[model samples]
Target: MPTSQAIQVDNLSKRYGKDVQALAQVSFEVGRGELFGLIGPDGAGKTTLIRILATLLLADEGQATVNGWEVRKNYRKIRSHIGYMPGRFSLYQDLSVEENLRFFATIFGSTIEENYELIRDIYVQLEPFRERKAGKLSGGMKQKLALCCALIHKPVVLLLDEPTTGVDPVSRQEFWEMLQRLKEKDIAILVSTPYMDEASLCDRVALIQKGRLLSIDQPGKIVSAFDKPLLAIRTNDMYRLIHDLRAFEPGHSAFPFGEYVHLSLRQPIWPEAIHAYLAGKEHTGIEIKPAQATIEDAFMELMTREVM
Candidate 1:
């Protein structure tokens, strides 16, 4: 109920049918004007959690509040105070860009003129194709239109479920820039995404997987938490590199990162030991060097541990 925490979810849980646990005792909060990210892979309960906050779905247990209103009990009120953009395009395909915006505004009992300033930054990019049907627009244009529709109502909270998914690199950059601008308006924003690169853009992020949270903190802190000495390894026989590393007694972790495989050891060991081990296996062109930890590295570490 405090003004500071605009969104609060306490011990929330959800299930699909008898076996699938979508969320389990999940809990977190979003402060006013904070840009919070729910970072995870697909089927990680990110979408389920977003829907509950948007009042589109009910949780099987626990509580969630938006703008000091309980999500399940005050869904009608919560719906009006929150702007939601689903992962997929849910707008009217046949409607023109301007028409779709007007329709959403009408549903919320608001006129475009009333909150024109709120979406002006995002809508201008779509204005050139205002008369174009929503279906005819490119992926980026469609996203801009969706964002315009979501913001036109001037809601106190914004719930965006993977807003950058499938968008081009340039559009993704532009969209994140728009979000940065919107954060200045003091609206609590909760966005979900599987992209680890985007986690750094948020004020704070919750790394989640398999309906459970691995860690929640600023992106830098998450990376800093990885205290192990990391090394990037690659060899001519890259295919067998992982298996060899996994078989090593000192190997604590090994995950592929683009051209290099990041490996962490359980105890302090010299690089010579790793080199000697690989050389004895007849692997040629072996390359190994110190590496930095990233959000992806941290997530993979946690996810791998959860399974082990």
Candidate 2:
């Protein structure tokens, strides 16, 4: 049985101007304390969706609720209870780190001292530079400060929109670790990210595109659902390899992945034939191996299926 919902939406839709539909009848429910991720690429309406849920933007159609407070009716109450960290760093660049934290705490009629422990772990990283202007801080420092400000009031839900975008790899890892600690405290977290690797960090993820929900499942379950045997093929000449593989009939799908090409032979029986053909082409260090499909692969397959 499903647990109580921390957030719920029904047939949500949004549009800008006349032709651009930002969202299209999207609906999903997130359970209490669950780290739910909304995964998609740019222009996938992730920001718009988060804005709506945060009570910062009105939806064109449908309704939603956070912590049992109706979004449309009790937006004021909802806003007070939800912490939102936008994709862009929107903190006061001229303000010192400590000043920024104090301001956000004051907005919620709370004090940093009252809820200090809630943000203490994250704020300690920023404490050394507490007197420094936000603009002068590095990407990672800014990220930590932003998070501290957002959590200063101990909101029931944390909504982070692509919070790991430009930070260093070490910082990204640290940020995720902090999230793990937050989740342990039973705070519901909804994070949106364009990166696929981050999807596995969440308890469950909703693969979204064009403002529509594609699939919602545990990371491992979603990956297990991937049907085709994926192949990671590498060669000395990747450019020529891609051209040749695409030229093969049955219209195989291939995309550049790191140093290799992720190729899915359109037809099952053609793997051997394709391998032999590639070897005949005098490709050096030719390696073809069955590979696991990642969240990105599942997302691509879902998008392709949607398009078809």
Candidate 3:
């Protein structure tokens, strides 16, 4: 482990029974004070990796260090130096919001007031509901309390596993803003999210699927690496457009994207050729134009490549 890295994982692999490989030789590093995102969909092993680093679970074969301490050899030390917020809200439902914070702080041999400066921004918002039961709080308020508890000890590293999975969009945005502020204090943060749009917010992201690492780099770099030109196509018949485009001779891939279908070509061809092909198929209102490659596009491309 380097001094600059807050967390380091090497060839970490974990399996459930004999068939389900939750993480397959997954390796990456989170630099100090950097916000690193583990981007993936459901059951993609994002949580597994986070748990390993958090010292909550062990890897079947591989090594991981948090805050310069080996996970297995120094579980206590790692746990003390890092904050972990699991995907699900894991707090005492009966305890008041302030009580939950106090409990976590006491567990770490500290008091909320001792580290009030570190969590002031979040705690202030939670002050109004300090006496409210944790279980009775709204989704956003619960999220805030969980984060405050995680930061009660003022850990150097933070591991958040899909913290915004079921949160409202506004809360999600606010949470990320809080994370940005946390980074200003030089606290390394490793966050996982299923949303591709959130990937861009991280300094760097590792795209994972089915327990395997697909790609790791800055969001912009990954998008820039998409070699093929992309086009957004839409027609009167949205459902048939996708199948028809995939059936086209020059089409390499066609997938529905919201109101339009994103099509990739095996080789560059004139737009007129695409227009003519669709027109021949009795497709009308055919609109095709160049589109920029996005993080979602890059993830889909990597998934397609992995399958092929």
Candidate 4:
């Protein structure tokens, strides 16, 4: 392991029973104070990988280290040095907001007054509702309380699994902003999210699918690696347009995006050629334009190649 890296994973593998492989030779490194993202959809092994590093679950093969401590042999030290927030709300819902904070602090052999500054920003927001039970708090409030508890111990590393899954847009934005402040304190942060748009927020991201890593790089680099000329097409009849686009022998792939269908061509060709082809098919209200590749586009392209 390198001295600068806060987390290191090498050829990590995990399986359920004999057939289900949750992770396959997944390897990555995160430097101190770096914000890293594991971007993938559900069932993509994001949780499995995070759990392994948190020392809650063990990997069947390979090795991993967090803050220079082996996950398997030094779990006690790792647990004390890292703050983990599972995908679901696992705090004491029956306890009041203040009580919950006090409980976690006590378990760590510390007190809220001792480390008040660490969670001041977040805890202040929950002060008014200090006496309110955690179970009665709304989604966003619960999220904040959970984060404050995680930070109470002043852990060197933070592991958040799908932290914003059920949050609203405004709350989600606020959550990311909070993460930015945390990163400034030089704590290595590893987070996972199924939302494609969230990939850009990380310094670097590892794109995973079906237990395998497809690509790992800066979000912009991943988009630039999309080598094909792509176009966005919109028609009056979306269903028919997709059917015809897929049947076009010269086309490589076609998938429906928000308001248009993204078409990837087998070879770079003039727009006039595509217009003529669509016009010949008697499609009405046709619109076509060049499309820039996004993280979602890159993931789709990588998935297609994997299938092929």
Candidate 5:
């Protein structure tokens, strides 16, 4: 057929009881050979959407398909062609690394020898611990082992839910590099994470918050679409900077970012104006500079509008 199958969702919705809406008519499509990221904070329905795609959870409304097979109609077929790695390390703790891989391969009616190349790169890193108990492995090793198990079946689509949530920085970087290599294999990869910085690594990202999608586009496009003047304000007293900036622009947006207070200006004003205003408040070491908008910044801007 095509290079690989696509994951499609249309007006997907999920709710818990009558109170919490886990997903609100979410819709998106992930093309083959593309790495699509669902970027959101905890409780933003990222996991729920990922679970639905993996056929582990059912949605209350709307339709979803993996590899053109509807989630409800042909779930077994879909499962056979897709690989899922949940946020947690779900491998058999008692099983050795090699045993775990073999177990998963046998369950899928395959063998490591049959699809060795698919996972060679990742598995090579874990080979030294082939006989080691999965639970005894380090976090990074555990992550690699789990990934090997997921890819042993040679799946056409890979679903990763918060794959790097608790991983160390270097391990996280390594894991992402593996994903990039896998993407080159024409596998449609859909990964969800709460880390905004990781959004830039994806081919496209969907910004979700509170079970609703805020924006969907390339990371660069999302940042560029924010056509507002962003400024970082720092002073000798960082705590008072936020209050002073808010007082200066009541209708504008001002929030703490790193060592400075980031302010989103609704109208253009020279940097000198802010210097004069903050100086009037008797603040020292005043530093005001234009800041670039990131995916996180764009998400915050959209969420702020949604609340107001």
Candidate 6:
């Protein structure tokens, strides 16, 4: 039989006030031991949804269940089986790394040694500086420590909200590696991130924006769904190229993507036309290259398709 869902949310909604709808009837299911992601930019209600699932906040409407326990009614039991690492570092600043880990383990009615294996690989990195105050640790070290404490109780479900944000590139890669190892232990994971590159690492992801669910599918499938031809054009006169490309076609959309401007041509446009336009403007060595659609490209299209 198919593994039962580790988490199920249906028609879930949350609002902070009359003006801000944090979540709008969002719905999805995370399978047991699956590494699911809520991918979106800032103020997209990711944190709001995570808080509600962690039992730190309540939804205004709809229903959710974590490991078969209703969120509204079985929060007590649910809390015991989950590990939550919020977007921000919320550990005791004054306490040492070891102290923070010990405190959290105690709060869950367990000890560090009892669940050492659960967080062993993560904790070892923090072991060298175990006596350092949490506030004094670097961004990467603090993140590792926070994760260790969250996992001290050997939770079945791990909820990490932007766990790699604000860390160095090396640290970010390491953090993802640790998460991959955790997946082998069959711990269900739900992580939220604004980084499009990280979406592919998830088994499945939901693209969200403005408190609404946009798309839900595997990363490759999401990229495959982007049915638009894109071209990357770059020239010595970067500013002029962007302007010319926009006016090249009546309905074309062009914007800078790193060193080049990625354009969605309204119809078939010749590379010579692109080169000629730039050449006429005294632009030099203009290069036009075919491009592939990425998650970010798909996200932009999904967000603006309704408006346009």
Top TM-score model: 3
Candidate 5's C-alpha runs over 4 A off are: 1-5
Query: How far is each candidate from the true structure, as Cα RMSD in Å?
Result: 1.4, 1.9, 1.2, 1.4, 1.8, 1.7
Q: Model 1, range 165-279, lDDT digits (tens) per residue? A: 8898899999999999999999889999888999999999999998998998999999999888899999998779988998878989888889988999887788899999999
What count of clashes does model 4 give? 0
Instruction: Compute each candidate's TM-score over C-alphas.
Output: 0.96, 0.95, 0.97, 0.96, 0.96, 0.95
Query: 1 or 6, which is superior by lDDT?
Result: 1
Clash number for candidate 6: 0
lDDT of each structure?
0.92, 0.88, 0.93, 0.92, 0.91, 0.90
Off by over 4 Å in 3: 1-3
Counted clashes in each candidate structure: 0, 0, 0, 0, 0, 0
lDDT tens digits by residue: candidate 4, 159-202? 99999998998888888888888999998999999988889989
Give residue 150's lDDT in candidate 6 (0 to 100): 88
Q: lDDT of model 2 at residue 95?
A: 97
Winning candidate number (lDDT):
3
Cα lDDT for residue 1, model 2?
Answer: 27
Please list the residue runs of candidate 6 whose C-alpha ends up more than 4 Å from where it truly belongs after superposition. 1-3
Give the range of the ten consecutive residues with the poorest summed lDDT in model 3.
Answer: 1-10
- What's the candidate order when arranged by decreasing lDDT? 3, 1, 4, 5, 6, 2
| Clashing residue pairs found in predicted model 5 | none
Our model 6 lands, by Cα RMSD against the true structure, at: 1.7
Tens-digit lDDT track of model 2 for 233-252: 88999999898777766545
- The reply for model 4, stretches above 4 Å from the true place, is 1-3
Instruction: Tell me the lDDT of candidate 3.
Output: 0.93
TM-score between candidate 2 and the true structure: 0.95
